[model samples]
Target: MSSARRHILIALDMHSATDAGLSTLVSIARRLDATLSGLYIEDSQLMSAAGLPFSTEINYLSAEERILDPEELLRINRLASAQARHLLEELSARDKLECTFAVESGKVAIQSLSIQGCDVFLPGRSRKSLTRKQVTLQLRQLVLIYENSGIFERMLEVARLLAANGMVSDITIVSETPLPAEITGKLSIEDVRWHFQAVSSTRPEQLRALRLNSASLVLMPKDLLTNLTERQWFELLEQLPFPLLLMD
Candidate 1:
């Protein structure tokens, strides 16, 4: 592990509901002395389908017009960009961490794929098909979830308290497959070395077996929880002897 600052990217939608995810990113960034980048992707396809035309002029037409003028599109883009900047600025003020913002027009997954050199992607907890597809495709990428809102500071404090108590040791990064060489290479450079391990078994029984064999905390991104029924997640939580940290 190296001492380089961690680079965290938080996927933003500018919705009030995403505060939890944003806070999580802020907390981690502050604790690690990391840089936090906020990302907001404007779904161009959705805008187009909604009758907004991506043109160069603002055409104020009736609802029947069915197309957005270039001016209208530009206005909307500007608003989104301002919202993203405000979110990052607020988080930076609260967490006292270095922060930046990026607003892009494209599909979220495609935009995320193009982002390079990020330590982790922290996304809000939503049952969106696009989110699922993106996470599935980027299986090797490290991800954290924002499970709920209004607890960013608490989460950071918890992480720090855990570290002090020696509870944040021997982390197991679970997945159904091995991580790509590129991701592993980056993880290798992280300075806070804890016996970083992984379990590729997808079956519940297999995961339980592995848990019994190691005395490490089990960590999984919250997005993965959406794929499982509430009962299933609860069962795993109850059955697993070790503490489970859900990064949302």
Candidate 2:
């Protein structure tokens, strides 16, 4: 089994979108025989902002301005964090997954620093409906999105890991141009399959189109991701609703 453990930082709040993606985390953990850890951020900013004496929000349901208080915010954070821990324990234990969870009190993005040593992980949630069969993505849809060979080897390494765990059915290498044969031939993970496709001219638009339903996991070079601003990152995420593995 591959020792490349995948850390999936997710919110377990019943009302949060991450709660729905919890199943995907379990599936990946079980398949990879990896440790599945969860982190729930007790956002301090929300509490801090609400603590302002004049802070108010028009409650969408009631259309009434609601005053905020520090005491009540603390109470809500405690309750939410507790619920998240309980849910994580129950679900993870049910699957016999080696799971651990932590609560960080800060911005959602900054909390990810806890897993900085990880080689790869799901940094956000994917709304793509996950099924038991697709846990390891048996759909044979593994897409590596990139522009060059600088990180092609790393992409193939991750793909091999997926194959080792039987998390991949087939792999698709999507690039701006065709990759050299010597590089393509190196993607030989036993009993695994893959193919490559290069777009003619446009890249971003074509890439978005391919991401819609072309793959279950989009593997990308971590450095390449820097090309996107935070907003663009989430926008691309919305397009590719499936899990994304950003690797070094």
Candidate 3:
């Protein structure tokens, strides 16, 4: 058995929802004997805006007059918090893994801050709407997404394939700096030292060097690609040399 504790961070939201994301996290955590952390960012702006009451009770309303009210915001926050807790509990129960929850108020990017010592990030993939600018930013390590319902099985298959081909021995999970709170809270370099041979610096150049030297395949959740324009998508494709396994 591996001695290192694998760490994973999950982004909790309403659309893609938390249940599926937590399910994936638990599965991965169990396989790696890792702990999971759940983060729910309460975008002050979004919450504030969504809290507004409708201008009129009728269905048709003027766009300019529509505004969120405090009651609405409270309701939304309650629902989001409930979902986040439910997921955390479920994952904790299944794997006997430690879990933590955070509800912060900030921009989406700020809320998505990295957890220190995390090996991977599991985020939900949704087709509803995309944040164009957010998708362009470079993120560290593997970004697991729910492509279809069967993504977990696919990942297992991929891991098995790599193991069979002797490629698994060379693979390692890496992350950028400012790791998530949950990771730093529960683990240390000493804990992971045996399982991961090296820790790459957070710099882009260092990351590139590590990827070239250590990894044969880089995995990311398909949702990371959702909001990109064709040009952006092609650019990302060109930049990556390894075959990306897009989890469904």
Which digits, one per residue and each the tens of the lDDT, describe model 2 over residues 1-248?
Answer: 33556554453322232443565556655664556566666667667888777987675447898787778877876777777667667778887877777776764434453355443444234444455444434435778785565556766766776688766767887777767778766877788777777766433324567644423667775555545445564465445455555554
> Which is better, 1 or 2, measured by TM-score?
2
Instruction: Give the worst 10-residue stretch by lDDT in candidate 1.
Output: 138-147
Clashing pairs in 2: 140-169, 140-170
lDDT of 1 by residue, 134-181 (tens): 322222222112223333223333344445433343233444555555
lDDT of 3 by residue, 13-93 (tens): 543344444454455456555566767766576565564555322222243444556666567777977877886777588
Off-target runs (Cα >4 Å) in candidate 3 are 1-3, 48-67, 127-248
In candidate 3 the C-alpha lDDT for residue 102 amounts to: 73
lDDT for every model? 0.47, 0.59, 0.45
lDDT of 2 at 64: 92
Of 1 and 3, the candidate ranking higher by lDDT: 1
- As a whole number from 0 to 100, the lDDT of residue 182 in candidate 1 is 44
Error of 2 at 236 (Å): 4.3
Candidate 1 ranges with C-alpha deviation above 4 Å: 14-17, 52-81, 126-248
